[model samples]
Target: MKLLFIALAFIGVAVRFAVFVSPIHEFASQRVEFSVPTNSWRRVSEGLFLYGIGVDPYLGDTFHETPFCLGLLSKLHRVNPLIIDILFPVADILAAILLYLFAQNFLEQKVVEEHKVKTSFKKESQILMLSFDCIRTVPKLVVLCYLCNPLTVGSCWAKTTTVFTNLLMAAMLLSASQGACRFYRYISLVFLALCTYQTFYYGLLFPALHLYFENFAGSKTHCRSRGDSVFGLLMDGLVFIGSFAIMLVVSSHIMGSWTFLRGVYGFLISAPDLTPNIGLYWYFFTEMFEQFRSFFIWVFLINICIYSIPVSVKLRHHPMFALFTLLPLITAFKPYPSYGDIGLYLSLFAVWRHLIPQMRQTLIVSVMLVLAATVFPVLWKLWLEVGSANANFIYAITLVLATSQVFFVTDVMLAHEKREWHLKHGVETVDKTGKRLELHLQ
Candidate 1:
């Protein structure tokens, strides 16, 4: 499974490199190139080098005050932008693998802990250990979802937000799984910081979701209960203060002073005026609203349906899944489309833990349709803009199909796990009562 996963990831990387090395359209290249200094690491890399040489590469011949990651990366070596693009997908795959390992270990721990609580030295204990094996099922599914993801493949060739978002998300998951007290947590912060400049607005969502996850996971309660309020307080302070710092740094780097905050906020709240005669929020709300409505609605409904299953709902309070669903929803609501909900990809993987039988197929088809709906627009636009099918498109479709397929395969696996869990617990009889049908473990 690991080899197969790695092979698929390399295929994605190959497609990215192919596109980067090829002679593509100028406009297409412009769209795909990492040129924008604000969010483009490549550009930031160049600026860093220029700065090291005592040359100002600012927009208007002034010193820039953005985060230092790009400058640092740039100073290391002179690399092609295409190479940099390839690195994004590669990083995503590597991060995804790390996430898989962490999740697998975490789930094992959960199984043991839950088994201990639910089963004592009784006949049920035997069944509980058998059921514990089922928890091991989720990690493979999660990794495969990332490996075969269409959006991930598509992101490989372009300077899109998806790759960075996924990488940061993977970092978050890895950190969470390792326990928040580790040095990796701070390292995760550095990844979060890098993500901010990689895609600016979209990358910001990762850290935002991280905070939400920390809160949802009972970490906030644990901290507060222990009277260690400083960490949580400091974290919240950072969200507000860091956001302002981002805006201030960007303004200082580009526009000078904080005047750009208005435009930034305005753009976030409303759409940019494409035409001179066009009005404000009208274009944002009405037009783009219609465009994304079906996709957004489908995502919401499908998730709700998937969550309706008993086992699925059981995970509702799990910090990872909770943050996964909420982050995407919040980011999706912004007037500007954000890949921040790339976190949703994680939720999609997490939900595979549920063992609902009847709704399984429906959930699979629904998720595929939603993914297609979300990704097709870009696929079609790129197809039309360029002639003929390309490697990236192929990668994108394969990823979409693979991710969707995981939904099916995982549902079956989860159902099996549920049955095993029941068997171990000695829940032999199923009773339909006036209130509800309950399945007990011993």
Candidate 2:
């Protein structure tokens, strides 16, 4: 454990030093430039520049970050940009540590639950399950995975604000999963609210995470009455909404007006930027009929939420796995999806390493991510710069990327269902005909 923390610090400094020394500095040499997405780091810097010179950041479409982010970056005007560069790696490190703590705590809870159901688990099945020593080291394992992953390193190298959002999200997870005080759960809600304030899509997470919070906060000794649970959730919802509202108000006050409400969020909901990226949105919308764009935009946004609510309800009992499933959905469907989002979810997958063995097409999904990330720049250059290929060429790769990610989401959900079936009935999952049931991907 001591050596793991040492390695963690080393990784933090190493990423910072590498970012400083590499040409990826200032988004040059990096294919995924920050300017392409809404609320990008470069855009915030642009906003901060305007704010420093007595102009509003929301005065134009160039910046889409919340005034809170702009205000946070405004502090950078006082310090060197290199300091902010160092800060991102530090955020990554902190987030890694938080995720480690959260995973360890979650695993401990699972161990306790498993003990209560020990009789149901068969002997061989229990042998294949996580060992006590392995459980103890899960934190280090999860943290090391995050630190060593290319997606995480790439996102940190790109200097996107996602590292900060990830940090907040990780903290919320840690707080909600651990700690005993009544106030701890509310603190987690505050962080969740802040996360939604920073990124709109996280608002959908409210139901799932609140479900997690209820499960975490509920007592095993006694069943709370239905009316009490409803009242508690209602009050928590108010807190979440109230905190988010206060955050928005504070952000607006910081920017001196509500103008940012449009510039930042409007750009997010409406896909005005047709810049090529890993997502499915840019290419389709780029060629879409301009007259019907509005309808389709709503359709796409609704499409993102459509599964979230129903899935949240159906899989509400398995909050962690349900959240895990939703992640790749976000990576697939977000209007401004990026590899950074993939990294965020992949880190969660690491925390839930028990699910990996159940996932079908692991090798295919891994290959798909590598191919997608590696080929995008080359194909993009061929189509946009070299002019030998048409938009369909790169769009095909985007299709591959989206399809692979959606497949992963489904695979994980199926894996979770399989695991639950085995746990409840027995390790031997068989049909009524007495044949072993295999998890088949559709």
Candidate 3:
């Protein structure tokens, strides 16, 4: 496993480095929202220039990335290639490694814990163990899945900021899985805030992560009865708010005012940029009228933010699944959806690979994923480059793309519930009447 991971890591680094230096980098960086101009290595260099000139990168509306990221890249503006080439691949490698460790931790925990409950009428007792052999192969699989993933490589090579978000997310997951570890808990909260700063919707993951911590104490009441639970939740909340506020303050100071907040974060929430991507938001708002813009913006924001509640509650017992469930929905609803964001979830999907057989609608989901991946570029070309097709053409592909993701997420959620069911019901869940039990979603 070590040897396999080492090889994958090297190959991943080499692929990203090769892509960075290759001619194809320009094309992919410019054309794909997966590597948008504002967040691409090239534009990052442009933003870096202002930092060198003692001007704030966040001073203008041209840059959309986090201030700290811009400052980090600015420090590398000169002779940065030497380190820059390694930075992205290193981030990818780190994310994979972190996931491997997280899987190990999760699986180990599963092996140690089981709840046995006897049926009222039957002589049989059911055992619930949340962990599958889920760990033994998981670490290696995540390393392979993420490092060898084409989209992951593409996003890394394109120097898209989403790669960093993926890294932070991986770290956050690892930290959250570490039960009773105060250091990791604080670190997770900080990273969570950083992710929200970078990508607004990531704030939704807060509830899931918090729920994980709450239950990591063994039970809800156990966690609640402990004084640390109250203090810990309070401290975590403070850390989250403080970290974000500090970042905002530092960025605001650099920019000479609070204007950057509106220029950057506001642009994100308001849907002003009509750049085409896989999201459902851009075109819908693009076609919207000036008079009704404010109304629709609030409606869209509310619609997007509302899901975090139901999802967090439904899968609270399965916090990791709850976290995973939010990805596809965000992909479909976010203001600036891109393939990079999709790639993050897709690579992470390896963790759920064990549930493949139980996944209903797998065929339809696979076909949709394939269609979206292939047809999107064609439609994008026809709509933008060739001008032979209208916006509707690409929008149609995006709809398919988002629908495919939605189906994929739903199927996984269904599979997870089934697995949990099996953990309680034995291999066969039949009644005395010889009827099979079925699962249904509300």
Candidate number of the best TM-score: 2
Residues 1-442 of candidate 2: C-alpha lDDT, one tens digit per residue: 6786668757754865587677765553245523356636677677778899999867777888777777776787577776787788889888988988998887787777677777877665675355566566777777877777667777777777887888998998888887545587789889989888878888787778777767755645267678877987897899899999999888877877889888878878897988777778888898899998999999999999887777787788877667767878876888887776787788778666777777787889879877877787788788878998878888888888888888788777777776766666667777899898776544
Quality of model 3 by C-alpha lDDT: 0.76
User: Would you estimate the TM-scores of all the predictions?
Assistant: 0.57, 0.93, 0.90
| Candidates 1 and 2 compared by lDDT, better number | 2
Query: What TM-score quantifies how close candidate 1 is to the native fold?
Result: 0.57
Instruction: Encode model 3's per-residue lDDT on 1-442: one tens digit a residue.
Output: 6786778768876787786567867666775657653356666777777768877666665667767787677667565667876787788778878888887876666555542233321223233333445677776777777878777777787777778888988888888778757688788999899888888788888888877777776553453566776876788789888998988899776657776677568878887777777778778888988899999999989988998979989998878778888988887788777777777787777777767877999999889888887888888888777999998988888888888887887889888887667766665678889998887665
Ranking by TM-score: 2, 3, 1
Residue 66 error, candidate 1, Å? 7.5
Q: Can you write out model 1's per-residue Cα lDDT over 1-442, one digit (the tens) per residue?
A: 6687568656644654555566532333244212121233344455666656755455332222243433434534455544555566567667667767766766775566556555443364344342555556667667666555544544444444345556765775566566545355455555555445333443433434354345533543453443343565466446534754664586456433443343333333333322211012222234455678557545533542342233323443343444343333333333333222332354354534444442346666567747754554466456656655543563454346435544544444445445554645454534455353443321
Cα deviation of 264, candidate 2, in Å: 1.2
Q: What is the C-alpha RMSD of each candidate to the true structure, in Å?
A: 9.2, 2.4, 3.1
Q: In every candidate, how many clashes are there?
A: 4, 0, 0
In model 2, where is the ten-residue run with the lowest total lDDT?
27-36
In the predicted model 2, the residue pairs found to clash are none
